[model samples]
Target: MKKVLFGLLLAGLMSTTQAAVAQSGSGPAVSYTETVLAAEIGKEILFRRALDWTENHFSYGPKTGAKSDAAAGTVRVTGTGKVTPVATNGKELTRVIRFDFVFRATDKGYDYSVGSFRVIPDPQKPEETMMLSDYIAQLATEKGNGKTFNDRRVTAQANALASEAAMSFRSFMNTMPAAEENTVGIPATE
Candidate 1:
């Protein structure tokens, strides 16, 4: 009976699930990349606020592609990801999850970024893990009852990615070549 239940649970939980990935360009991204991102309502709002009071940015890395002749060039980016629960509780009441992120970026003919990654869940979230496990287990048995679950999951994912992406960009752009880092401090010992 336990084996039958586990099999049915796995089958149901796997069928309706999808994954998400949030990424950024690394090498020779075009200007439109930021423009495209700024169009997002959440991003625009966050960036506007971030720019107002933050003095952060990314140092410009070496350019990878040829110089643009047509005013501005373009970039193409892609990512593949999978989020899977790594471990299930003895009673299937707890779960440890891992999100494998495989990402790459290109511009014209040059490669920008490529990497694989994962999400390491917080250790203190054992209770949340148990709750999620119960939810997934329920999702398996309850069938269409996951309507609310799906909706909540989608909204949570969207908001999280948008928020994180915006913060990352705010930090990144503040460190670039042209960013002014105003400070008053004694020079550090070398």
Candidate 2:
């Protein structure tokens, strides 16, 4: 019975999970990448709020490939989308990365996790995406063989990508509207 229960739990977690890779201290580390916020609102209200926010911001609607579930005082959403990087010279890089995002919400707040990040080489070309993990591993391989300028460039790009995504998520949550109170914003007698 214990094994069965554990299996079920593991399955549930796996059902809604994805990536975060560690970058050189300058950026958000993917190691155990999970964010949890606290709010003084009801679970259902918070869940609905989160659903509305993501649906509005994310490119696709819930019915259009985004997975969402609300139950047991928790809400979970998973979706795939692309993030664009901006260059220092006020130019935006055309190369976009496809990423998997997992969001979990509760009465207090919510948690967002991004992983399975891959670069989509060309929009007009066939999908030839490379996983950020694989790219990082290749950098390690190159470092072992003595680092070159290209290796350093790749490392910097990966780190910047991680930083960009992290900031975007943080900003989104930070800017979310404050929980609204019902009935003239006054405390009701029990």
Candidate 3:
């Protein structure tokens, strides 16, 4: 009877841990979509600007940059970047994150989405980025009461990076010359 009781208690604890972990929600992939201003101008300029932005902000090799399917009116880009964790007088750690960006162009405007982000600890080993809930769970375990990690701050920084990327494309569009009639490709299939 004592053995049975002990087994039951252990099972209960395991279930509680599973429940707590499950409650932490999905990961740190933040999806963002925006309508770009120069859709009618052709996707070429958009692709170019996106490539430039990726090169400047994210680490990309000579062969990397925007991948576009003109017939499908879609462009995708994937890259990784290193961000320094804010100062806490801590270890001065830098985190590397990878992201996927997709852009779909239309006649009047273009839609872009950014997501599929993860933290890459080593060139060979990549880990899922922690969501705000996951950080909160860590805080609880550490009894940090917000001292262990600033989840909100990290989230804000991620958002700011995304916003900056969008703004870069927008700025490029604003300064872009209108497309010549002959240069514009056929409208993408419905």
Q: What's each prediction's TM-score? A: 0.26, 0.52, 0.57
**How many times do residue backbones clash in model 2?**
4
Model 3 clash pairs are none
**Which model scores highest in lDDT?**
3
Candidate 3 total steric clashes: 0
lDDT of 1 by residue, 119-157 (tens): 223446622332232334344444443333432342234
Q: What TM-score would candidate 2 get against the native? A: 0.52
Greater lDDT among 1 and 3 belongs to: 3
* Local distance difference test, each candidate: 0.30, 0.53, 0.57
Identify the runs in model 2 with alpha carbons over 4 angstroms from their true place.
Answer: 1-32, 37-39, 59-64, 72-94, 121-125, 139-155, 175-179, 182-184, 187-190
For model 3, residues 37-102, the per-residue Cα lDDT tens digits are 665566665555455555465432222355767666676886555544444546545666656677
lDDT score of model 1?
A: 0.30
Ordered list by TM-score, greatest first:
3, 2, 1
